[model samples]
Target: MRTHDWFSRKKDCDDKGDPEAVFNVLDSMLKDSLERLKNMRESIPLENVGFDSCTLEAVNSRHATLFGCLCSEGKWKTALWLRRKLIQKGAVLDVFAHNLLLNGLCKIRDMERPDCLIREMLEMGPPPNLVTYNTFIKAHCLKNNVDKALYLFSTMATDGIRPNRVTCNTLVHALCKKGLVDDAKKLLCETLSDDKEKTNSDLITSTILMDCYFRSGDTVQALGFWDQMLHKNIQIDLVAYNVLIHGLCLGQHINVAYGNFAEILKRGFIPDCFTFNTLISALCKEGKVEEACHIHDVMLKMGVAPDKISYKMIIQGLCFRGDLVKAIEFLNCLLEKSLMPEPLIWNLIIDGYGRCGDLGNALSVNNHMLSLGVAPNVFTFNALILAQIKGGNNVRAYSLKKEMLLNGLFPDLVTYNMLISAACISGHIAFALDLYDEMLRKGIEPDIITYTELIRGYCMRGNVKEAEKLSTKMRRSGSQIDHVPCKILIKKYCHLGEHDMAFHLYQNWLMREK
Candidate 1:
C-alpha cells in the first residue's frame, strides 16, 4: 500500500478524451523512481512502441524547458549536477530550468556529486527560495550536519523563507543526534507553538526524532518524546518501537522495555526477528539464562520460527552455564532443523568443551567446526590446546600445538601452561622445564600455576635438591608456591627417612601460608 504515488495529478485527461496524453503520463512515471536506482530491474521497457531510437534520444538533455518532463521521467536528484554541468558547457536555459535542476540535485538528495555545481549555483545571481532551503536542510539533516544546517536555518527568515514542519523536524533530529537535547527541545516547542498541526501530523519525522533520542541512551527523554508524539496521536512504526526496545535492552532496563513493547503491541506494532534477538541477547548478557530460554519459547509460541541467531544465543547461554548436555542437544536440534551453525557458534561449543575438560569432545566439536568450513581462530586454538592437554592426549596435543604454530597462532603463556602441565604429568620434567624456559625467552612469564606444576613434577621424581632450588627461584621471582607440592616433597622425603629435608619442606609450607 505504501507505493510511490506515481499515477496521480494531471490524470484529468481520460483515455477517450486524450489517448496520447494518458500514454505520455503513464510512460513518464515508470521511467524513474525518486532518486538513484538501487537496482535496474527492467530499467526500461525493451519494446518502446517500435521507437527505440526516440526512447534512446531522451537520455540527457540540458534544456530548462524540459524540467517538467525530466521531473516526470527518471529520478532527478543524482542527475541534477550532471545536467547543470552540461548547461555550463554552453547549454541554453528556460523557465522550468531552475525547477528541473533543483528537483534533480536537491529534491531526491544525490549530494555525492553536487559539490562544484552547488557552489556555482550559490554564486549565481538567481537566489534560492524557501523550498530550496528546505531541501538543502533536509539533505544536511540526512547527512547529520546539524551545525551548518542550524546556521542556515537561523538566516532563513532574512531570505524571506519560513521553515516548515519538515524543516523543524529535520532541525530537531539533527540537534538531538548531535547531543543538543536542550536545543532540540526548544526548537520542538517553537514549532509546536507556531504550528498547531506540526507535532503529531507528521509521524514519520517525529518518530525519527524520537529514535535519535532513543539511541542516545536517553530513555527518559526518549519516552518523553514518545509520549508527546502519542498525545498528538502520531503513528508508530514497528521499527521505531524495535529501536526503543533495543536501547532499553542494551541499557538493561528490561522491565520498562517490556512495558514499552506491551504498549507497542497494543498500538499494533508487531514484533519481529530483530525485536526478539535484541531482548534475548540482552538477557543472556546479564547471565539470565532462564529468562532467555523463556523468551525463546515465547517466540515459538507466537508462531515465529527462531532464526539461527536465536538458537545461537540460547546455545551460548547454556554453554556459559556449563550445561553442555543441553547445549549439545540444542545444537543437534538446530542441525535437525537444517541450521548450519556459523563460525561463532562453533567457537562457543569449542570453548564450552574446553572449559568442561572434555578434550575429546572439544576436538570433535573443533573438527565439526572445520568441516563446516569455519577456519579456526586464536581463541579456538586456545580452547583446543587446553582441552587436549587436560584430557591426557599429549601426542595429539603437541601435534595440534605444532600445527597451531604453523598456522601463526603462537603459543602464549596460557597455551604453554596447558602443554607444560601435560609434560609434567607424563614425567617429562626436563621437557616441561624446557617449555618454561622457552616461554620466558618469548617474554611470556610463567604464572603461579605453571611453576607449581613444575615443582610438583620435580618433587615426584625425588629431585628434592632441584625442587628446593626451583622453589627458592620461584619465590625470588615473586611466584607463590602452593601446599600440595610441599606435601609431595615432605611425604617423599619422610617416606625415604630424610627427616631433615622433610622438616625443611614443612617449614617452607608453613612460611608460604603466612
Candidate 2:
C-alpha cells in the first residue's frame, strides 16, 4: 500500500510518454526506500509493487544492505520480522539473505532461532555455505561454548562444507582470549598440518598466540612463534607486524620490537599510530623517556599526527618517570596545539603534580580545566582534595568537598576515604564520624579502610570501647580487615595497662583465624 505512489508515479510518467521521468521517479522512490528500508520493508508490498527487473533488483540489494545494518545495530528481532515479511510477500530470500539473518541471531546470542533457521536452510534447498557455519561457530566460541563450536567444526566435514580461513581464525582467537593459548597452538598446528593452504589463517592464529603468550609473560614462546611465522614466509601484513611489535614490547624486548619496526618500514608498509604508540609506551615503561621522546619526534616527522591516546601515553610515561614539570609542559603544549586535554589526561597530570609535592600546581591545573569549561568529575575533585590533604591543609580539603557537593557530584569511595583518613589524621574524630554517617546516608558502602580509619580515630580519643565496636562491625562487613589496625589497638590497650583486655582480643583473633 505504501508503494502505491511508486506505481502511480511510474504509470503517470509512462502515460505522459516521458520515459526519462518514469525512470527518475522510480529511482528516487527506491533511493528513499533504501534510506528507510527498516521502516519501508514493513509497510511496502514486495509482491505486487509493479516494478521491472532493474527496480526489483534494487529492492533486493537494498534489503540485503538493510539486513546488514540491522545486524550491526543488534536489532535481531526486527531483522527476523523483516525476513518473515519478505517470505510472506513471495520474495525469494536467497542464501545470502538467510545467512545475514543467521549472523544477526548469532550476534544477539538468540540460540533457539539460529538452530531453527539452520534447520530451515537445510530443508529449503540452498545449502548452508561455509559463512553460515562460520557465523554459528564464531558465536559459540565467543560465548565460551567451545565444545559446541568444535562439534560444529567436526560436522562441517560431514556436511561436505569445507572450513575456510575465517573459520580457523574464529576458533583460534576464541581459544587465545580464554587464556588457553596452549590449546590454541595445538589447534593451529593440527589445522595447518591438515590443510597447508590456510596460510593467512595461520598468520592470524600465530599473531593471536604471540600476543597471548606475551600477556602471560612467556616471552620465549612469543618470540619463537614470531620466528616461526617468518620462517614459513607467511606474507605478514601491517597488522601482523604491529601485533609482534606490541607483544615484544610488552615482554620488555624493546630492542627486538624496534628491529621489527625497522623491518616493517623496510618492507614498504606505512606504520600506523598503533605501531608508534606501542613502541613509545614500551620505552616509557622502561623509564627510557629520552628514547620515547625521540620516537615521539620521529612519529611527528613521519606525518602521522599523534592522537589523544598518543599524548596520554606520553604524559603517563612522564608522570611515571617523576617528571611532573615536563608532564605539565606537555599538557600546555597540547593546549597550544588546540588539542583540548581529555578529562583522563587532566586527571593524570593533576595526580602527577600531586605526587611531586606541588599541590599549588595541581590546583592550578584544576583551575585551568574549569576555565576551559571542562566540568570536573569526582576524580578531578578527589585529586585536588588529596593534594590539599597532602599539603596539610585539611580545611581547604573540606572546602573542596563542599564545593564538590555544591556542584552535585556524588562522592565515590575514594572521596570519602580520603576525607575520612585526613580527618582521623588531624584528630577530628567527631568530624570523621559525621562524614562516615553522611557516606552511609548516601548508600556508599564503607569498606575496611573506612572502618580502620574510624577505629583509629576512636582509639586516638581513648574511646577503646567504641573502637572495639567498630572492629566488630569491620569483621562482619565482608571486607578483609588488615592486622595493622588490630596491632595498633593492642598497643593502645597495653599503653592503658589493660593487658587482660588486649590478651582476650588477641585470643579472639586467633580463634577466628583458626
Candidate 3:
C-alpha cells in the first residue's frame, strides 16, 4: 500500500479502538491543515472577505467528510472544533452542522440547551423537519417522560407536519407503558383504520399490543397477534418471545412455552438466562425432572453457559420432589466452581431434609449455610424444629429454639403453632398446655392454629371436660383457627352420645363464615 494510505488507515483505526494512532494522526494533521489553510487565506480570500470567511471556506469537502467520520466514531470534541471554525466565519451555520449538533445534543443529555439549540437551528437558513421532531421525541423518551412524547405527536400534526411510522410507534409504546391502552387503541384506529397494511402493520406498535394482551390474560389474542407482525415481516426479537413465554408459564402451559423457546432458537436468537430460567421453572412445575436435566446437558452441548439462576431452578425442583440427595450434589457442583446458592435455594433443601425426618442432614446443611456467611433466619430454625419434632426428638428441637432466640431471631406464629402441634401429635397434652401459657405470657396473640391445637390435644387425651372448656373459649375468641377441630369435637361428642354439645359447636362454627 502507499505510505499515505497506510497512515490514513491507521489513523481511522485509532478513532475506532486504536486511540493512540488516532491521536498521532490528528495531532500532525491538525497543525499542518491549520497552517496550510492560513497560508492559503493569505494567498486568496483574505484580501476580499473577513479573515474568518477564508477560514470557514478553507474547510474543504474532504475536511467535512473527516469530521463526519469522527462524529460517527463518537469523537465529538473533534467534530465540535470543526463546527466552531465554520461558525466563527460570521457565516451562519448550515443544515449539516445543525443536524449533527442536534444529534450530539440528543446523544448526551444537554437538557437545558435543547430549546435554545432548536431555536438557533431555526435561526439558521434551513428550517427544522420531521427528523428534528422525531429526534426531540426521542430525547423526551430517553428521560422517560412518555406524556411529553405524546404531546410532541399532537403538536407535529397541528404544526402541519406529517408523522411517520416511527413517530406513531413511539407514541404507541409510551402509551402502553402508562397503561393507556384504550387511548392507544383510539389513536391507532384513527391513524391506521384505512391503511392497516401501513400503520397497524408496524412491528414496534404491534409488539406493544402483544404485551398488553399478554398482561391482561388474553392469551388467545396475544398469540394470534403474531400473524400481523409476521405478515409485515417485522423480525421479532428476544424481548418479544420473553414476554410471550412468561405469559404462557403464568397460565401453566409449559409445553407451549417450550415451543416458543424453540421458535426463538430457530430464528437464530440466543436464549438468555431469563429465558432459560423460565423454561426450567415450567419443566420443574410439570415434574419433568428428566427433561429438566436434559436441558442442562443441552445447554453445555450448545455452549449456552448456565447462569446461577439456572442451577437454582433445577436444585429447587429436586428439593420439591424430596430428592435432597441429588439437590445437594448439584449444589456442591456449583460451590466447587465457587458460586454460592441464594438463601431461598438453601431453604428448599432445608425444608426437604426436615420433612424426611432427617434432623442430622438438616443441621449439617444449616451449618454449611452459616459457613457460607448466610445467617439462618426464623424460617430456617423453624424448619429444623419441625424436622426434629417429626423425628420424635423434641428435646433437641427445643434446644434449636433456644439457639434461635440467642441468635436474636424471635419465633413467629408458625414456630409456636408447629411446636404445640408436635406436642399434641406426640400425645404430650400437658407439654402442649404449658407452651400455650408461655405463648400467652409473652403477649403473642393466639390465632386459629394455636386454639385448635389446644382443643385437639384435650380431645386426644380423652379429657372431654377440658376439651369442652377450650371449645367454649374458641367460640368467644370468634372465628375458626380451623373448622376441622369443630368436626373432631362433633365426632367425639356424638361417639359419647353427647349430641347436644356437638350441635351447639357445629352451629357456632358455621355462623362465623357468614
Candidate 4:
C-alpha cells in the first residue's frame, strides 16, 4: 500500500474502536512528523503540516505523550503547535507534561516562553513541581543569571516546595563559577546543617566545594574538605580524584599531582581525558613539553583517545617552544585520526613558521588549510602580512590586505597598524596618510600606535610642522605622547637648528608631566 493510504487505513481502524490500531497509527504519525521536522531546512507555518483538531481528537489520550516526544526531540515549534491545539481543545496537560515542555524551552534558552508558561501553571491548575522549579533554576544558573536563580530558589520555599540535592548542587556550582566561593560555602553549610543525612551522601556537592576552594587558592581548605570526605567514609570517585589532581597542579605541586595519578592507577581507577589534559597543560606551562609529550604517548598506548583539547595543548606547547617541526607532526597526526583541528590550531602552525622567518612554510600551511576547506581568519592573514613585511616584501603584504577585502574580511586595527607602519618605514608617507584616512572612514579609531607611526613618518620626511600638529591631535584624542614621538620631534627641531623651539617643546613636556 502507498504511505498515505496506509495512514488512512490505520486512522479508519482507529475509528473502529480498535485500541491497538490507534497506537500503531500514533507510532507511524509520530515517526513521519519527526522525520519531516528534522528534514525541514527552515521553519515554516505549523498549520500546513501540524495535526488539526479532527486529527488531534483521533489520538485523544496520547496527546501528552506526543507533545513530550516532540519536546524531547527539540522540535520546539511543532511542540508549541501541539500545545496550542490541546489548549484550544480544552485538553489540560498534567504537571509532568508541563515540566517536560518547560525543560525543553529552558534547554533552548527560551526564557520568555518558560516564564509565561510557569506563570500560567501557577495561576491556573497543575502548579509547578520540584522538577519544574529545578529546571528553571538550573537554566538560569547556566546562563550565569545567578541572581535570578537565587530568586527562584527562595520562591520555591514560599511555594512550600523544599529544595533538594539537585537544586543545592546547581546553585553551589553557579555561585562558585561567579567567584563567590564564600557564598557557595555558606549555602552548602546551611543546607548540610538542615539535613545532616544529606552531608554524607552528597559527594558531588562536596567535590564542587573542594574544587571551588582550590580555584580560589585555598589549598588548606580544599585539603580539609578532602580529609573530611575520607573521615566520613564517603566513597571517592574518579571525578573527585581528578579535582584533587587539578587542584594540586594549580597549586604548582606537579609532583603531588603525579603521585595522585599513580595512586589512582593503583586503585584501579582509569584516568580519563580530563585527568590527562590537566597534567599535560600544567607540564606544558612549566616548559616540560617532553614530559607532556610522554603522557600523550602513554594515553594513546593505553587506548585512551586524546580529545581536541589534548591535541591543542600539546601542539601549543610545541609551538611556544619554537618546535614547529614537532607541532606540524602533531597536526598531521590529528588529521590522520580524522579529527579536523580548528583554524586556530592551523593558525598557530602558520604563526610559528612566520616567527622563525619561514614565510614559505607559512603560506604553504595557509594553502593546505584552504585546500582542506578551512577559511583563514583575520589573525591568520595578520600573521602572514607581518611575515611578508619582515621579509622586506611590502608589496606582497599590501596585496594580502586587498585579498582580505575580497574575502569579505575588513582590515582591523592590527591590520591597519601593520600596513601603516610598513608604509612609513618604506618612506611612502603619502600612502600611509591615505591609509590613516581610510581607517577613520571605516570607523577604526587610531590608537597611540597609529599616531606614533604617522608622526614618525612626518618627521622622517622633514615635515616637522605636520608632525607637531599630529602630536597635538594625538593628545587631544586622549593618547599620551610616549617618548618615541616626543624625542623624534625634539631631534627634528634640533637638526633644523631651531634650538629655541626644541627647548620650548621640552619645557612643555615637563609641564605636562608635572
Per-candidate Cα lDDT values, in order, are: 0.73, 0.84, 0.77, 0.88
lDDT of 4: 0.88
Tens-place lDDT digits, model 3, residues 300-372:
7877777788898899889878788889988998898788888888888988999998988988998899998
lDDT of 4 by residue, 172-196 (tens): 9999988898898888777655655
The C-alpha TM-scores of every prediction are 0.60, 0.74, 0.66, 0.79
Question: Model 4, residue 162: what's the lDDT?
Answer: 86
Which window of 10 residues has the lowest lDDT sum in candidate 3?
A: 10-19
Give per-residue CA lDDT, model 1, range 182-246, as digits (tens). Answer: 78778866755565665454565657666777677777776776677668676667876887788
Question: C-alpha displacement of 297 in model 1, angstroms?
Answer: 3.7
What ranges in model 3 sit over 4 Å off? 1-180, 187-201, 426-434, 437-445, 475-482, 494-500, 503-514
Candidate 2 residue pairs in backbone clash: none
Could you give candidate 2's per-residue lDDT for residues 78-140 as a string of tens digits? 998888877766676667877887888887776789988888888973588888999899889
The CA lDDT at 163 in model 4 is 84
Give the candidate number with the greatest TM-score: 4
Off by over 4 Å in 2: 1-82, 104-115, 189-197, 333-340, 355-360, 371-373, 391-393, 406-408, 440-514
